[model samples]
Target: MAMESTPNIVGVDLFCGAGGLTHGLVRGGINVKAGVDLDPSCRYPFEENNEAVFLERDVNDLSPEALAPYLEQGDFSLLAGCAPCQPFSSYSQSGRSKKRGMDWQLVSNFGRLVQGLQPDLVTMENVSQLAGHKVFEDFLGYLKGYTVRWSVVECIKVGIPQSRRRLVLLASKLGAQGLELEYDPAVPARTVRDEIENLPPIAAGEQHSQDPLHIACSLSEMNLKRIKASKPGGTWRDWDPELVAPCHRKESGSTYPSVYGRMEWDVPAPTITTQCFGYGNGRFGHPVQDRAISLREAAMLQTFPQSYKFAPDDETIRFNRLGRLIGNAVPVRLGEVIGKTLVNHVRMTQGEIAVPSPAHHGRLF
Candidate 1:
């Protein structure tokens, strides 16, 4: 018996914000050729850390003709499209009717490219809420011949130190068995302490002298008082009557208790959001520090490497910009899992390795 040659897995990432998914794919041994996105800010980080070409173009305008050349360079081509998740995110569900802008169509556009190019493999990651949307079903309709597997994945289950849940999909044209992301129950879920507790502390409105991204946003005098009163794992309910915000005093605001809170160090942090730099946003307050989590801490919680650079040296690190970039990224650890799964699936299909029994690994259906 002779062993077969395994194909080299190559990938092109669409909507590749700050190269988080690309970095994880590289870490998982895929040879990523390029990443495409509309944001020019992503160019520096995507190219700097991943050693891949960064195309500054909107995903909707990208045609298969433009991307086919990159896929042609490898034996097993992969297309990854983790479009901006805001349209399907729970945060925007309240205003969904008014806010259903251009982003809502980007996932369908991804489906267009997948159908047109007919790549060997395809993967997408987005907020779990996307699964409930009609767009997800429409996207699935486009995959006429591919075997698909997808599920809502808990970030901590994959070692990411955040209580985030995302929908992950894998589609393959190769064989009947298809592909699924593997989760091992024996792997301990990571905690906030494991990811960022060792970093030198910085007060509100201060930048770490050594690392620029470690800078925290400035707090107002009143917010300073509110954060000081905040206890880890506790909400605004812990504050004294005088310290409570007028909004919270209103009957409508009473339901929103996760705000103005601190994260417990022993557990995973809450989902890092676009407003994660604000202490009043969600449970973003630092456990013991009298400030919100710094831009770097948020990035680390998103599973980006501490050394991951978000901007050019000459560029200013504005809270809103960096916060949106870090928050919108797919946790790198999840991307690695997707990458490794694709590699193993290809090898097993090629007869280069034995496929594990279904009982050996957890499956996401």
Candidate 2:
């Protein structure tokens, strides 16, 4: 049988940070037209690495009319809205009040665009914890006429070298069915060693001569001792009692053992958080190196290409800002999974690919 030409599915990314999802979508064969984000820092990386324009506008200010120009260019349209997941993350829910403020409403803003535009396809990625919230149910209400499927996807299952998990949603207005991300169990899982072992070694507080982003943050004299005693995949319990922080001596701090820990080289890394560059944050310490992982290492673990540029050489590399961008991004490998699913879904609807049994359609795995 003659294979039909692949459809031209153009996409616009909402809350696109550093073009992670956009880059992955492009790799999966989707033509991303533009990436929209409020951060001006995202512009350089978004445009430099991918064939997309960067729109530095708040998603709250975006209207269907604003996206019309881009949507008109493709045979099928995709609106990807990966709202900031902090408000719905487990870290926020642990002890804080659940306030429905500006951050929480960003998901609603995404729904508004979907309601107004009624695009051919829509996708959303967020912390898996969001699936239990009322806000998530309300977001589903916006997809009344479309076939929807959502599930918590393990990043490692899709070739990401991190222990991160995210909720992924795919909805289609076309008659296609059985939408789910494809994963290959036969494929070997990537590891921290695979991602960063080859990079030139540098001491704590030293920057790699060739790669600016490969610089590690400086450690205090005490932290240097603590890290020196740390073992791969081990917790603070391995530390000498004198090196233990006063906070960890408290009863409540006993519950937080993963902090001030080191990663294991043979396995995937912990979920990269906004403070992943700090040794005291999660299990972010390098398996062998006495310092925390570098910004480049964090980005690479998020499955971003090693060559991905975060900023211009002339600008100073701010650790906090770059960490936030890299941490909050959807793993590029997962985005590629989404893009491939969307492209295959479109082909099924167009009769270019065989549609799966209806019994498997519309499942919420």
**TM-score: which candidate is best?**
1
Could you tell me the TM-score of candidate 1? 0.93
Q: List per-candidate RMSD values in Å.
A: 3.3, 3.8
Local distance difference test, each candidate? 0.86, 0.85
Clashes found in each candidate (C-alpha, N, C closer than 3 A)? 0, 0
Which stretches of candidate 2 lie above 4 Å from their native place?
A: 1-4, 89-103, 355-364
Cα lDDT tens digits, model 2, 200-317, are 8888898887788898999999999999999999999998899999999999889999998999999999988878999999899999999999999999999899899988877788
TM-score, per-candidate, Cα-based: 0.93, 0.92
Local distance difference test, candidate 1: 0.86
Task: For candidate 1, write residues 50-109 as lDDT tens digits.
Answer: 888999776777899999998989889999978665544422233122244536677888
Candidate 2 lDDT (Cα, 0 to 1): 0.85
Model 2 sits at a Cα RMSD from the real structure of: 3.8
